[model samples]
Target chain A: MDLTVKIRNKTLPNPVGVASGTFGYGEEYAQLTDLSALGALYTKALTVEPRPGNALPRLVETPAGMINSIGLANVGVERFLTEKIPYLETLTCPVILNVAGSTEEEYASVISRVDSQNAIWAYEVNISCPNVKHGGMAFGTDPVQVERLTKTLRKLTDKAIIMKLTPNVTDIALIAQAAEAGGADAISCINTVMGMVVDINSRKPAIPAISGGLSGPAIRPVGVAAVWRVSRVVTIPVIGLGGILTWEDAVQYLLAGADAIQIGTGNFVTPDASVKVLNGIISYMKEAGFQKIEDFHGHF
Target chain B: MKNFGSSILNQKEIAIGYREMTISWPQSLEAPLPGQFLTVKVTENPAPLLRRPFALSGFDREKNTASLIYQLRGPATRLMATLEINSSIEVLSPLGNNFTLPEKDETPLLVAGGIGLGPVLYLARELDKNGFSPRLVVGGRTESFLPDLSNLKNGSIHYCSDDGSAGFRGTAVDYLKSLDWKELPSARLYSCGPQGMLNACHNLALEKNIPSEVSMEQMMACGVGACMGCAIEVIGPEQYARVCKEGPVFDSRRIKWT
Candidate 1:
């Protein structure tokens, strides 16, 4: 089956990839599945410096999903370049680095440092991370700020830049358009919905940060709707995510016009979710007599 | 660490809401060291999506079996408690780093409160096999909350209860203070319990100039360090460490107790 999907100049092996943060640095999950079979392996959100992240009680399970406030906990870019990048360079699949910063300059600086790396085929600009107190969701929520940051990053690297849009905004289509206007090659929609789980007995927040970004099955409808809405307004390729546990869910995103799909919290449920989704997609394709990934792209 | 399925051999309730579950282990897989844990999938369904991590309380090399002592804490554990015997459960084996074994000439002092005795019991068994006679101190809110240590060998057990129903009549920290400080200098302390109890143990070991190691608890999703769900503050240049990756057991000085 011809399962490849093209976003800008780079070609993904398939339209199935594991979301950032859910699939660590590719090193930890390498033994669990075949990395080459994946479309891409997205890394955890990395900052300019090492972030300690939030305190204890970082995670809490909700109705059909889980909440987490990891605060972009990661080893800095220097450490990533020195320690993690070398391992990522060895992987057969494309490594998409998710970069975050408090300011435009910080984002540009991180992109500049990593731009020269041959192993990293693309960049997923995490302009919308609700867990952090500063930056992240700030730039992504405003169309103007999204354009400025995306434009700044667009000037820094020729590599495919994916603007990971936040769903907290009033109109996600406006943000997606702004990202496209700023020369973004692709768009990844729905970076966890901002939600909270309270401890009824303690009368306090369950997660240490008081509130957290909710991911998993509970957020799937929201993510699919966001991707469907955003894909309509933007000409760039759309990568959809949120609560993608099965192959049928991945097909829903593909039918909704997502060029590719990323499995987020579902990775925690099954370590081999990406491969399983990929294999299932192939089976679905064969069963439906579809020849290529584009046969069902935005079919609905 | 390898991810595989282990069949249940036996499960028996030792206390109200507490069960001792023994699972079959193939001889091909290496036995887990003291502080390492297995993230067991209590259900195949996505409702309880994440696997629940449990410390290996005991292992029989020749019999090729392992046991986990757990108390019913939440929906996941409740599901695990109802799992019928002989049914295979998907488990990610030997996740996280293990507790540090003591050096020669150092006496191991093991401390645990409530269900924290899971790893502590395993450590004691390992110590005894190495020809070391370790001292164990256990505490609970009441006698019912404490584990039965009659099956364990080669350790002098000191018990303390908050309600004074059994053992001493105060907190575990208070019990530690009642011990002779002079006799603790040559001891290497290992503790696993509530945050307050661990903090107290850390301070007491510091005061006595004895080195201490503590096993920390954190809510986790993927026990293989992929999710970054279990972040713990460490007192070092790097402020955060994943409890699933860096440690479930760490030197007492490395943790930021606050």
Candidate 2:
């Protein structure tokens, strides 16, 4: 079975990749698994300025998932290009830089700085950061804003641009269509369902940010539904993510019409979760007498 | 840092609800620093999902044995307390940064609160091996809650209890405030305990202008840096640093105690 996937002119060796924010530049996991075995690596959210992030009590475990209000803390663009990119360049797989900003110009500026790097194959524009107060969901929830930001970014970088959409919207398909119209190369759906946990004893929110993005097994169905709905309206490749823990979970996203899958919270539980998911997909394909991911793409 | 599946060498309760578990690990697993920790997989099941992180209390270089002292506070720890001898547990170890050691002429003053003694006790032992006699102040809710410190050689321990069931009639912080800096000049302070205790010690250290280090605790998902889960804010510059990565240990001045 073949596993190659094309996003613009770039060809991913497989359909599995580690999600942004969950994997820290893909440098830490190299010791646990072979970096070349997976399809792609999406780094953490990159802002124009170094972010200190949010206050304490940033993480809390729930029923079958986790909530985080990390607030996009990162080394910023300058240090990322200097200190981090050298290690990321050594890997054989494609690296997609996940960029976030508090403003449209901030996004454009970060994209402009990274557009020349050979190590980065694509740019995942993050318009849906729930932890921050502005610029993230503000730009993502509205279809017009989504189109405008993508259009502006499309003019700046020659690299493939993938619009990451938030799941908190009333209608996700409309937003996906807007991104496609704005000249986006692909679309990655469902950047964490917005949710929060309360500490009953303290009578306060579990996270200091009061609310956070929920990711893990509990949100799998929501992610599949969003991907299924968005893929129906957009012609661009849909990268599905959210609550993917096992090989079976990855297959569900593919059957729902996601051309590729990104593993997020699963990496925290098991360091080599993406590799395991990739192997599981290949095994299932062989068993079902199917050859390549295309045979089962959107089969549902 | 490395992840190893180490077998339980022996385990027994040292306090009312605390257990001291020693696990036999491969020789390749390097010695963990005093303030470093390990993320433990309490059970074979994934229900709890995240591994429970514990401070490295002790280790034996020749025997290739490492030890962890933890209290039965949550479901994960409850399950961890019931593990039989010889049962193998997955341990991701030598994580986070360690406490900075003081100079030969500087005095080491170690403070611990309740089960927070985990790292403090280890630091005391380490200082002892280096020919420095550290002064350890241990406090708990009651005498029964305090772990035995007889095994900590080459150091002096002052026990304090809330109900005056042990050495002093007040908290560790109160005991710290009672000390006269004039008598013990150039003493470097190292502390780990409840947030209240750590905060009190931080303020006292600031007032006395004694260089201090604190080991902070928070709920963590991945013991590694990837999750960005265990976050704490710093003073002056005011930014967040992951407790799992930047530290479970930091300069007392770096932490915004509030």
Candidate 3:
């Protein structure tokens, strides 16, 4: 009956968390759904300076997914402390601050500035955002840079550090191991699969960025397989995401060796997706005679 | 905004590619205003995973009904067109900011291009109901692309087409330019349309020394402010604003028009 997920010193009330970027600092969904019922809330990416983001046509719909090139558009860390943290403090669930920057110093600076905030429960290191030209996936694609950044940030705060990985890389298990070796409490994958859609009439890329990170049901299989591979390589808990819309889709991640699951693009499909998935998970566990989230894992 | 369970009361194609769908609204929720919008879950199937956003074309408080005008330009709308009447659907209602009303002495000029007719028409009707004289100019590629105008009798309505197959011989902005400025000396413009049309309207508003508001359209994911997608650059320190949150309606002067 224990749905709690423990990573190092922090324990999530349940195994369901809303993905970063989709949840927008927990305040945006406060009016739409119950924030206290969530296991965790991953915030939009916060950078060193406020980002203007990409140009027009930042989003485009595919068959069962969407490509987003938001380029980490955020209010920066200073404003995060002044403007966003007050609202986040009111939420009952754990707040995982999803951090991103264009350089190692920028990443460290952001973490150092907000590391003192009591509301922020953990840091979801975002080294996998594919929309930005520099830093994001650059630090994530290589194991050396991943370990170096993780090791450096690990020293800044005692809070749980979860390295979010991108699916665009070849051999994601290696990247997971790198995060583990550098003192990460856990790792989450996959950030988003790189994809593109062309406007045939205009004869140009659908999004102004030309290519964006694809997330939705279309990338669920890729996410599950990546979790399966990465979970085997690292001892850290694997937080699975990418295209989880229903409880059934979430159960697929739990069965695929993910310790917990995050609803990414699904949050857009329905605001109450996390609560629905959580309720469904409890019912599924009762029906299967499984007492804990771990029971759904390691069967394969 | 609250998510409401609504059922289709009526669905009909009023134009070659445009369809008007009326749904039973919940009395418990606030009635949707002219510029506010709703996102509909077209199907339970995940193929068109994201809910499509549509502006409130009409809302009848007495009957508890709200209507939307959608174009069959994509898979979502095409699927929406196939939905059976009285079938239940999930909708997130009354989202985003609305257009501000003009002063007592100011004339309201509402312009629409193609599918953008939904909110503009609604604004014109609402303005008429409020005893304000409003002028509506709707433009499209041709007459076939325009919606049925018989029901829109509350205010003055004009039509224009690129091919000169309808009312005016040019675009909506061009039609506005041809009008005598002295008659509409104290006019405020409101528009929703293709980006080019919106830009032209913004330019025309600047040239005439009139204030204007524009309803913007962007491909949205989370129709709420959660996703930073659907961002439109604006003249501000923040540099960007979400179409689903800060607008779908904005002051024409605030937009960092390209």
Candidate 4:
């Protein structure tokens, strides 16, 4: 089954990639499933410093999904560079580093620190995070800042740069345009949308942080709509995510014009979620007699 | 410890071959231990994305199946309730660690609160099956919510309720408070349930000097060890330990209780 997807100069073996923040360094899920089978692996968003993250109740379960405010907790770039990057070198599939920061300098600092690593195939700029009280919304919603941050990442490294945009925006296409103008190689759209759940019994928030990002099957359609719109407007390839659980779900994204699809909430449910989707996509290609994953992109 | 391929096994009502739906490796699952829980990924919805974590009630030796018992808490739980017999529930487990079982001669009194039964029933059966006589204390708001305890045939079963609707009318703590600790002061104790109930038991156990273990429940992310999402400030030197790694179960004396 033909399942190759070309983003910039890189050739992905399949259209199924692990969405940022879901796989957590690609090694954690290694104990449960095959990581190499995925088209690519997206690491959790790493900041410049190790984060303890939000307090208790960082997550909550809704009808068909869960809301999380993990606050992009990571071991920071220095440690990730020293510890994570070395481990990543062992994997054959392309590992995309997700970088997030409160300030422009911090983002640049983390990028510069990992800029020399030849192992990394691309960098996903996490301009969206809702749990942090500061800077979470600064770069995500504004078109100009999205452009500025995307350009900054572009200048920092020759490694392919994919700007991740938040769905918590009035104009998602506008942000995608900014990333393109800033020279982003590709764009991964629709990060978690901001939402809050309150525990009616205690008169308190369900998630201890008062609010968090909503994800799961509930967010898939919204993600699909955003990716569909953005992919239509942008010339760069689009990596889509939200509530992608099955092979059919990935097809929806690709058909919605996403060049590739990332498995996010699905990963939390099943660690080998990426593998299932990838295999399913391949199986579908064989059954349908498609020559390539891209051959079916955006027709639906 | 082995990385099983990814795919969610649906939830279920019962397991066929085993008397009780004892999910085992190739049957239920491999990794999840007693205290460790597996996140049940519910794909039917999308707004909330993370899989819900449930303590393993038993171990599955078969790679093809996993066994779990859950109440109709919400959509996720409701979805799990309709699971067919022998149908696999997508699970990640043998998680956390089994409550440290006492030695051959050691007697442990098992106290389970409400649905807290989900995480402690296996331990109770293990002790009973091993000939380690343990008295089972099961508590619930009303007798109607009580899970079937006939599987625990080797032990004595006691029921407690808040409104005097059952065996002891008062709360489980009330029954516990009134119990004759003198007879079993030397017995090891294991308790799991709501924080309030556990705290009451914790104090009573300490006041009576009966060593006890309590399983602490908290929201989690990675379930393995990373993300630090399930940390508790009741154990280790720094007053913090991971529920997923260090324990969903802890020695009552070692925890801060809050």
True contacts kept of each: 0.69, 0.51, 0.88, 0.44
Candidate 1 lDDT, B161-255, residue by residue in tens = 99998899888778888988677568899998898989999998888888899988999988888878887888898877888899899999999
Task: Give candidate 2 regions above 4 Å deviation.
Answer: B43-46, B177-183, B236-238
Q: Which lDDT tens digits does candidate 3 get at residues B126-228?
A: 8988988888999988998877776444468888988999899899999999999999889999999898999999999999999999999988999889888
Which model scores highest in lDDT? Answer: 3
* Cα deviation of B177, candidate 1, in Å: 3.5
Scanning candidate 2 chain B in windows of ten residues, the lowest lDDT window is B41-50
- lDDT tens digits, residue span A1-300, model 1: 788889888799888888999989987887777888889999988889888778778999987789988888888899999999889988889889999999888899899988899999899999899988774789999999999888889988889999998898999999999999999999999899999988999999997799889998889999999989998898889999999999989989888888899998887777888999998989998998899877776466
Error of 2 at A284 (Å): 2.2
Per-residue lDDT of candidate 2, residues A29-135 (tens digit)? 76666778879898998999988778778888876788888889889999998999999888889999999998999999999998888999999999999999984
Off by over 4 Å in 1: B180-185
Cα RMSD to the true fold for all candidates: 1.9, 2.2, 1.5, 4.4
Pairs of residues clashing in candidate 3: A1-A291
Q: B1-258 in candidate 2: lDDT tens per residue?
A: 766789998999988998999998689878998999988877645456677899999878999988989988888888888889998988888888999998988889999997788899889989988888898999999999987767556668988999999999899889878887788888889999998988888888888898999999988887788867788778665477778888899998899777
Measured against the true structure, the TM-scores of the candidates, in listed sequence, are: 0.95, 0.94, 0.97, 0.85
DockQ of each: 0.69, 0.54, 0.83, 0.37
lDDT of 2 at A10: 79
